[model samples]
Target: MWIVLSLFTALCEAIKDGLCKKGLQGNNFLVIAWAWKAFSLPFLLPLSFITPVPEYLSLRFLGILALGGGLNILATILYIRAIQASDLSLTLPLLSFTPIFLLFTSPLMVGDKPEPTGFLGVFLIFLGSYILGSSKPGFWGPIKGLFSEKGPRLMLCVALIWSIAANVDKMGIRETSPFFWAFCVQAFIASGLTLLLFKQQKSISLGSRKNIFLLSLIGLFTAMGLISQMSAVNIGLVPYVIAIKRLSIVFGVIIGALVFKEKDLKLRLCGAMIMLAGVFLMTA
Candidate 1:
């Protein structure tokens, strides 16, 4: 069940990315980022009222939510700037490091670790993702640039933050229901971004009917992805769940090929095959 939910979450994430790509033309980064959270409120806010609340809330839960939301906002901003700062081929490959970071953070923060086979699966997923993004400069160049370059360095920080944030999410979900926690975290993030936008004198106006509609779609998928992800993390191992979630990269490649007629399909397809093999090892 967790595996299925994780795949659904990956699908939702891939679709949201594609939609955001389409919507990114006229919109500023901050506004689109805000829309990713704000527009999801229509779907997410309702879940708060409908879902059963936890019997006992604790200070730890409140702290986890606050810390997780803050970390995520920072990660999101760094993520956006990383892409803007450097080439996609370089920065994106660094995202695979998240699972590796999780290997340490998981046991420390959440007191959980994957089996040896599952750990190997995580490593393979990282390798496959690196290959998927290693188009122009090849493997060594990107690997070498991980620290010296600004974008890769920023993305590495984002990965490290996400690794810790994942554990925080697991702790928060343990204290509250997944639905409620999802709503709370997202609401916090949306509110935080709203303030940041205001500080920058940026308006949240989506502008243009088509752009608005596209972002709405992004929001819808974002909500679905959030719910499914939190639910999966609640019951599944955090490292394994995150490893599966990175399947979004494979899905993104397929979507780009079929929908947008993007090139470089063969190389990425090979990488996807490697990722599937790793997932099999972990799930089997």
Candidate 2:
């Protein structure tokens, strides 16, 4: 049942990522990220109320939350920037390196060590990501159909930050309700920092009524996916949960192909299988 819930959580995360990609086309990436968080308040605030937040947080827990919040914001900002600047196919596979980063750091943060199978799983995930993310060539390139140059090295930096943040979340989860507190802290901090760092311009407005509604809907999905992922970690192995959650890439590829009319469905499907196989190996 927990595994099923984790799968659903992955689906939500994928859907939200897809929506983010759709919404970000031709839009300011930072502004869209801010808008998504702003729109998140309505849904997330109510969740905080309904879910029963703890009256008093432990000092240790509070520190963990703060660290997680910082990392979350960094990861979120970098992710948006990376996605906007690079191809999803390229950026996402690189991002999949998060699990490998987590594997090494989990022990220091929370004293959890991977079994031999777990290490094998981690290797497979990276190998699959490498294959999937490698770029194809244009008519001018060497492959004429399979050669591609690397994207921003900065995105890899962001992926590293995201990896650390994910492991931090696992550490934070052991100390509190990962769903409620982590969301509250990260959302609050991210929103506040965004508002502070990016001065609101008079020219910047929410735009059309339809876009507002749509963006907010996407925000709600983001909140749901985040909370669900946190909840899944509360019950399952952190690394395993994350490994499985990355399967959302498969869902993203499918939605991109079917709904958004993206090209290269066959290649993406093949990548998805390799990814899933890697995930299974990681957990086995």
Candidate 3:
């Protein structure tokens, strides 16, 4: 059941990415980011109140929420920049690095240890990334290209930030219901981004009815994805759940090829499959 939920989360996330990428054609990243969170409030805010809260909230929990929410805002903006600057296939695969980053972050943040199998999973994921970046003759070509590419480099930063935020999310969920934690963190992020959006543009504009509908769809899918993800993590191990959730990259690649008519479909699909295998291995 958790696996099913995680897969659904991945689907919603992939769809959201496609919608956001379309919306980015004429929209600013800040406004898109703000809308992503703000639109979700209509669904998440009411659900949060109905869900049972923790018996007591601690300063530690609040600190984690604030810190994680701030990092999320940064990561999200970088993510938007990445996709806008490059192909979805190129940017999304680098996110596979998140599990690798978690290898170091998990121990410190949540006192969790990766099993030996997880190390193997990490190696497979790295191999997939190498393939994704490969174009020239020698191994050094792909390795260098991975770092040299603007989109992939930004996504690497997103992966690192998410590794920390994932742990913080687990910590938050441990203290409260998943719905409540998601709502609070998203609200904080929305509030912060709203301020920045206004400061930069002075006013928000939905552009047209068509764009407004697309942006709303992005938020709706994002809200559903996060809710499903949080619910899965609440019951399952964070690393395992997140590893599966990263399957959204595979979905994203397919969506890119079909919707955006992205190039290099053959090689990208192969790399995405290899990465998906690694994600499966993480559950072992």
Candidate 4:
């Protein structure tokens, strides 16, 4: 059940990424990032009302929410700058490092210790993700770019922040219903990103040539993705859930080949097979 939810989350992630790519061109990353969560807020708000709210809110819950939200906001900014500063092949692959960081952070933060085999699966997912983006760099550039380039370093920080944030979210969910916590986290992130967006642009717009329906679709999928992810985290091991969610890279590859008519399917599908093996190890 959790695996199914995780896969759904990964699909939503890839869809949202594609939508954002289509709808958010030529906008400040802050505005685009704000739109990512902002539109999701409307969809999540109703869920919070229908779902039972916690009778008591704890300081620990608030602390975790703040920490997680802040990390994500910073991560969004750094991630944009990272991609802006370097080649896509150089920086994007570093995102797969999240699960590796999660292996340690998950146990330390949320006490999620998967079996030894799960660790191998996690490694393979990372390796597969690296392979997916290694087409232009031949692997050495991404490895060497970690220290030599600002983009890789920033992206690495984004991955690390995401690792910690995922665990913090798990802890936060334990304190409240998943629906309520999801809304809270979204609200918190939306608020923070809103301020940044306005400060950066002085005003927000839908961006040049962006379709309103397209932006809404991005938010809708993002809402579904987060809801699914939080639910998965509640019932499943963090490493397993995150490893499965990282299959978004695989989904992105297939989408690229099919929807965008991108090339290199042979290599990307090989990487996808490796990630599928990782998922099998995880769920089997």
Which lDDT values do the candidates have, in the order given?
0.88, 0.67, 0.79, 0.87
Instruction: Tell me the number of clashing residue pairs for each predicted model.
Output: 0, 3, 0, 0
Q: What are the RMSDs of all candidates, in order?
A: 1.3, 3.9, 2.8, 1.4
lDDT of 1 by residue, 1-284 (tens): 99999999989999998888777778877788889998898899888888889777788888888999999999989988998888878998898889899989999988887999999899989888888888667767677887678998899899999999999998888888899999999999999989998888755565778888888898999999999999999999998888888999999998998888988878888888888888998899
Which candidate gets the maximum lDDT versus the true structure? 1
Candidate 3 clashes: the total is 0
* RMSD (CA, angstroms), candidate 1: 1.3
Please give the distance, in angstroms, between residue 222's alpha carbon in candidate 1 and its true position after superposition.
0.6
List candidate 3 stretches off by more than 4 Å. Answer: 80-92, 129-142, 145-152
**What alpha-carbon RMSD in Å does predicted model 3 have with respect to the real structure?**
2.8
Candidates sorted by TM-score, best first:
1, 4, 3, 2
Candidate 3 lDDT over residue span 6-124, tens digit each: 88998998898789888878987778888989988877888898999978889988998999899999998898888777665466657767877887888897877768877776667
- The sequence of per-residue lDDT tens digits that candidate 4 reaches over residues 243-274 is 89989999999788778787877877888899
Weakest 10 consecutive residues of candidate 2 by summed lDDT: 137-146
The TM-score between candidate 4 and the true structure equals 0.96
Deviating ranges (above 4 Å) for candidate 2: 84-87, 135-151, 200-204, 282-284
Model 3 lDDT on a 0 to 1 scale: 0.79
Stretches > 4 Å off in candidate 4:
207-210
**Model 4 worst lDDT window (10 residues):** 206-215
- Write down the TM-score for model 1: 0.96
What TM-score, to 2 decimals, does candidate 3 have?
A: 0.87
